[model samples]
Target chain A: MALFFRLEEAVSDLIHDGDSVAMEGFTHLIPFAAGHEIIRQRLRNLTLIRMTPDLIYDQLIGAGCARKLIFSWGGNPGVGSLHRLRDAVERGWPNPIEIEEHSHAAMANAYAAGASNLPCAVFRGYEGVDLAQLNPNIRTVTCPFTGERLACVPAIRPDVAVIHARRADREGNVLLEGIVGVQKEAVLSAKRSLVTVEEVVDNFGPRSPNAVILPKWTVSAISVVPGGARPSYAHGYYSRDNSFYVKWDEVSKSRESFLEWLRLEVTA
Target chain B: MSYTSSEMMTVAAARALRNDDVCFVGIGLPSAACNVARLTHAPDLTLIYESGTIATRPAILPLSIGDGELCETALTTVSVPEMFRYWLQGGRITLGFLGGAQIDRYGNLNSTVIGDYAKPKVRLPGAGGATEIASQCGRTFVVMQQSARTFVEKLDFLTTLGHGRTGRERRELGIRTAGPQLVVTDLCMLQPEQDTCEFIVTSLHPGVTREQVQQNTGWPVRFADTVAQTAGPTADELAVLRELNERTARAHRSDS
Candidate 1:
């Protein structure tokens, strides 16, 4: 069974220091509020994971909450560089954060493998690419029958997976619609999961054809945080805050402005 | 009215698409080009976004893959795993459109890091779906502004395989699909030499000279024996492109 709590209480109870966490969202439904809550609570030394560690990861990294980042891509999306992420990697201003990079295919497969209780994810990837040279975790395995070579990366079973969804029922079943990323796999692949939703409904209404229904038992805790995935939209709830993304370029460029902005918006 | 070089490049890239082509679209130039194609020549073009929106027909240009317009207008949406495992790796997409920070003679891209991977001067966004898209899509079309800084002789890191290996070597390694077919730049368009798979200038956009193209490239650039000037954007094409831009601006205005 899953328990429901306020966003602050949930973050305090579920996340801890030195935990490997995946705040999974592709470009949509990125649990910004929950991420901010984690920052507010001053969780430290987290190994943060995502396919594209955009604004939220930038915030987490900027706040000195992350020890490492495992991701495929990191950027401000349609703008230019993520300055805070760049600051951490290039200059190590807040703290020296380690990085483990993979391609989108590998990350998706790894998450699936974790969900399936597999040791490693096998895929036809990294062929003639140079990432294999740098990352030791990326190696090759031969198929049993065909004898063809394939790339392999260890399964990503995180300590905690956090996500934002459109809605959840009283029974704790969650509904996700529109451009659903690896949220389901991220939830299942983790030892524990935290879900934030736009609302806690009496019953999940008639869903769209493509909605993902995560039943109660799969989740550990549910937090009803309206506008949780702000800046990154929550599908039916709101549109993506494009203006804010454009503004982030300026605000995140310098340390003073970034820290001030974080202090005012995220921590305050 | 005369069009700018950037607009010419976008129009040319858009005209390259045919109807019903499943284009795995990226952000920036690729997105603009594909959407232009959708609104005009390639109305039936199936736009597959990395965010798992398949056959998306957005009302306006999407700011990013996760733009709400994409999800709201998509024919159907799937999870990220399904998007990669079934659609991309399954080789269902007909084309992949990309933009990159650096590209080598072989068209191998480097969006990862600038000087060194460990100690970097500039840390670029690493490969998202670009690695698989460049490798697995039936073919890829790269759109970038022609400059020595971007069109490099060698990449800092090979993030995606374009024609890094010859056909024989690729066959030996069990890799298939023509990697990058055409690279459309503001100055000229390049096609790989059939034998060497080295990108060579096949056509120059109107008013752009071979000398100008050569001056911008890092390596000694080669040209086709019969290099031709790309036909300027047609009146209808310009009209459509302008309308698309206007609509995008209007869309963003209302959205904000």
Candidate 2:
């Protein structure tokens, strides 16, 4: 059964030092509040994983929380670069965070493989690409059945997974609508999962076409944090704050500005 | 209508898509081009986003690939894994449209880093879906502004494959797709040479010179035997493109 807790309590209880964390969201329903809570609690040495590793990772990484980042893309979405993430990789401002990059296809397959209890994900990718030269993890395996060779990457089984959803039933079943990217697989692939919902509702009401429901038993805990996915909108709850993303380009430009912004954000 | 060279890039890229094309759209220039094609000539063109939004017809442009408008407007949305595995790798996408920071003569792209991968002067967003999109699609089209910086003699890193320089044919290397057949840029349209797979100027945008194209590309550029002048953007195309862009600006700006 899934338990309900406040955001802080859940972050403290679920996340720890040296844990591999995946805050999975494509460009929507990103759990910004939970990421901030992890920052506030000062969790350290995390192997953070995500497909995009957008703004939240920027914050977590800029705050000196991450030991390594396993990601495909690290940018500010429609905006340009994630300055803090760039700083960490290029100059090691906060720390020299190690990086293990993959393509989107590989990350998606890896997460699915983790959820399926598979050792590695096999796919037809990285053909004629130079990515395999840089990353040792991208290797090839021959299919015994067809004598065809395919690319393989180890499964991404994280220690903890966090996400923000549109709603959760009183029974703790979470509902995610619109741009539901690897959240379900991330949750299932993790040892523990925490979800922050916009509200706890009596009924899920009617769902649109692109909605997903995570039943109670699949989740470890639920935190009802209204507007938890702000800046990175929670579908029906709000719009993505495009201005904030534009502002982040400036705020994250310099180390001093990032720290000052972090101090304000953490204190608030 | 007097369209800017930047608009010419988008218009030229959009013209590449046919009515029956199932385009796997990238963000930025590719997105705008794909949407413009859909609204104008290729109304039946299917726009697939990496966010799992398949057959999306957004009223306005999406800043991010998976913006609310993309999902809500999509015919259907799958999980990211499914989107990549079934729709992409399963060989359903006919065209993969992309943009990049740097491109080489062989048509390989570099969006990863501007310097060494280990120690970078400038770090860029690594490969998202570009690798598979470039590899698995039936064909790929790259839309980026023409410049010496982007059209480089050598890439800092190759994030996606087009065609290997000499010995490594993408087909011979077990990649079945026609990788990066065309590159639509601000100044001219580049197509791969039949023998070398090196990008060569096939058509120059109106009022652009062969010398201008050579200056923009880093390599000692080559031109097609019969290099043709590109048709200017039609009045109707410009009107629709402008409307789409204006609506997108409104939606994005108002949200802030």
Candidate 3:
């Protein structure tokens, strides 16, 4: 069974230094509040993983929380580059960070493999692309029966998985709607999981067509955090603050402004 | 109708789409092109986003791939794993649409890094879905604003395969998807040569000279035997595109 706790308590209890953390959300239901809490706690040397490392990961990277980033794409969505991520990789602003890159198909399959308790993921990927040659994790496996060569990558089993969602019942069965990315597979792949939800309801009365429910037994803990996915937005709850995404381009341009953001918005 | 050259480029990209093409839309220019195609001529076009929104018809442009607008308007949404496995790799997409920072003569893309991968000048957002899209889709369309920097002689790193140094590389490797078949730039439309697999200028936009195309291209670009002048965007296309963009701008600005 999953227990409900405060955001800070959950972050403190679930995350620790040097942990391999996976905060998986596509663009919707990103756990911005939980990320800020992790930063506020000043965790370090963490291996952060996500497919698209958007603003939340950028903030964590800027605040010097991550020692490495494993991601497919690391941009500001429709906007441009993540300056903080660039600083860590290019200039090593707070600290030098290691990076492991993969394609979307490879990462998704790897996560699913992790969820299935498999050693590695196999798929037809990166046939002639140089990305497979560059990364050691991306290799080939020959089919014994058909004599076909397929691409394979190690599973992504993280130490902790964090995500935001629409609602969680009193029994701690979480409900996710709208653009559900790899959160379920990520949670299943991790050793422990923490979910931040818009509300904790008595029961999920009626569900949407594309609703995904993670049973309580699968989750470690939950936190009630309304508007937790601010700037990113939650489906059917609040509108996406698209302007903040646009404004973050300027705010995260320089280290000084990023620090100001930390002092005022994050740690304040 | 009077339109910016970029608007002409977008229209050209949209015009390339047929009613039956199931386009896997990327973020920026490709998104604009596919949406324009859906809003204008190719109303039956099936648009799939990386976030697993299949056949999404958004009224306003989404700032991110997983924006609620996309999910709300989509015919159905699936998990990311299913999207790549059953839909994309399963051969549902007919055309893969893309935009990138740099391109080679073979249409090979480099959106990963600008300089050395280890020690870089600028680190770009690495390939998201382009790699699989390039490999899985039946054909690919590239939309971009052209310049010598983007149309490079060599890429710093090849993130996705278009055609290898020798075009027979894919055939040799037993990969059969037709890679980046069409490229639409602000100045011209390029199609790969049947023999060389090198994209050569096939049609130039109105008032854009061959000298201009050659000057902007990094390589010694080749022109097709009968290079044609592309028709400018019609008033209806321009009006519809402008309305869509304006509504998008208003929504993002006001909602923020």
Candidate 4:
């Protein structure tokens, strides 16, 4: 009753060409390495959604794997520069990337609604802003009881959700010990889910019941990939290479250099 | 008299910040400056970030503004719109910390294009929430290394306008934000004159001459009649910053 595989194999089967995939992790933590490998396979026209896209997203976009992306910010880690995504937007490459400029929580709420089989969620956060003008997908719906106009964000049920965690068992019981945000909702909202962890235990005996971030029932495939959040530091595996990030920013300034760098760092 | 570029920038930023100011802090330089203020002077400063964190107080410097570190220690986390509309546009925010690819004399920023908007020679990172923050915040503090290429006479494209045309024109247009209040660089700190949008040297770091500041600027940089000496970072300030970085690196290492 347990499904297990390597990182690459797990992602290869979970993702398909043109599938809408939601990835967990922000900036540089717990990004699905197996999911990245799936992108390296040249899965074309794929739609990727994240709270914020970083180097991995840029690589996917550059590789022609991603046709569209939805996120709040896409850029080099610290410098707050997002040249790759900007160029694609300006040149109108890979079709116009639909941008949903909302907070990470708002996007998670939309996914939560989808997981709960709801049409939309009324959020009070976006009351008076031009974010409505940017997305156009979100609409104003009147609350039945209060008669107050609230922004109704549509559900986002991605075809696949790929997440990387600290530890897991053969049966896909995941333990994410630190900050737990929208990872649970992301797994539930997706039709199928893949979990890649730093280590795989024989069973879920070592972890306390409360420490389990995702239970086995929600996960379809599990992969044990040591150092899974490569380029991005795994929380306890290694310190983030600040020097590497600085170098990446310098190289990513130019389009040609960035493409070559990605091909080498990500694909190989 | 000696300070790292990051430390010097932080000192300049800390001095520029006012009490009860709401600041949209970018990562790196902005984070250092804001945290320094929190530690020393501006304890009531409200920090709003694009990551939806409000009034963040990280014990150490965050790896990035969007890192869970910010959210974990933040006083409150709201949706992105509330940060922009209610806090920013509603004029609750007083200052914005910005770093840019290029800046013009009028304080117009160019994070978008290098040549033209239609067919840009180099397409820079398109404006994120910076456009809104610059336009709506009560005042914006720009931090960049002083250089001719960055301090252009006119920007390739207006990614964020500090003053629509000029200080006079900005007033005429009824712009809400007071526009770019101060420009802090590694060499010196510059401020826009009251009636004109032209930047004048307000303070120079030790060993940085007025001529050096002017030479580095792209426009006809003016100097204040009485330019003051920029205070160097104290031993305590430098120690705290280094300790923060070391702790953050250690935390990441242990977690990995």
Instruction: Say which candidate scores most in DockQ.
Output: 3
lDDT tens per residue, model 4, A1-268: 3677766777778889999988866443546476568757878888888766777676677566777787655567565555566666666554445444544435756777877878776554342233444557767787799876666777778999887777787666787643344566678889999877788777756555556367788888888787777666555554455555556676776778886776776777
Best by TM-score: 3
| Interface quality of candidate 4 as DockQ | 0.15
Each predicted model: what fraction of the native A–B Cα contacts (within 8 Å) does it retain? 0.81, 0.88, 0.89, 0.12
Q: After superposition on all CA atoms, how large is the RMSD of candidate 4?
A: 6.2
lDDT of 2 by residue, B88-157 (tens): 9999999999999999887889999998889998999999999999988999999998899999998888
lDDT of 3 by residue, B1-256 (tens): 5789999999999999999999899988899889999999999999999999999999988888888889999999999999999999999899999999999999989999999999989999999999999999999999989999999999999998888767667788888898899999999999999998999999999999999999999999999999999999999899888998999998989986
lDDT of 4 by residue, B1-256 (tens): 4568767877778768876888889777777788888877777888877656888888777666556567667887654434554566567777889888888776777665577655557655555666666766778898888799999987776656676555465556445458788889999888887777777888998778878888888988888899999888887777666777688667655533
Runs in model 1 deviating more than 4 A are A208-211, B165-169
Which pairs, if any, clash in model 1? none
List, residue by residue over B1-102, the lDDT tens digit for candidate 1. 699999899998998998979999999899999988988888999999998999999877887778888888999888999999999999899999999999
The CA lDDT at A159 in model 4 is 95
Candidate 2 residues A1-268, lDDT tens each?
Answer: 2489989899999999999999998999999999999999999999999999999999999999999999998899889999889989998979999999999999999999999999999999988777788899999999999989999999999999999998899999988777889999999999999999999989888777646788899899999999899899877779888878888899999989989999887746
Per-prediction TM-score to the true structure, in the order listed: 0.98, 0.98, 0.99, 0.69
Docking class of 1: medium
Q: Which pairs clash inside model 3?
A: none
Error of 3 at B198 (Å): 0.4
In lDDT terms, how accurate is model 3?
Answer: 0.93
The DockQ scores of all candidates, in the order shown, are: 0.79, 0.85, 0.88, 0.15
Q: Could you give candidate 1's per-residue lDDT for residues A1-268 as a string of tens digits?
A: 2489988888989899999999998889999999999999999999999999999999999999999999998988888888999999999979999999999999999999999999999988888888988899999999999998999999999999999998889999998777789999999999999999999889876766656788889999999999999989887788888888888899999999999999999887
Superposed Cα deviation of residue B146, candidate 2 (Å)? 0.9
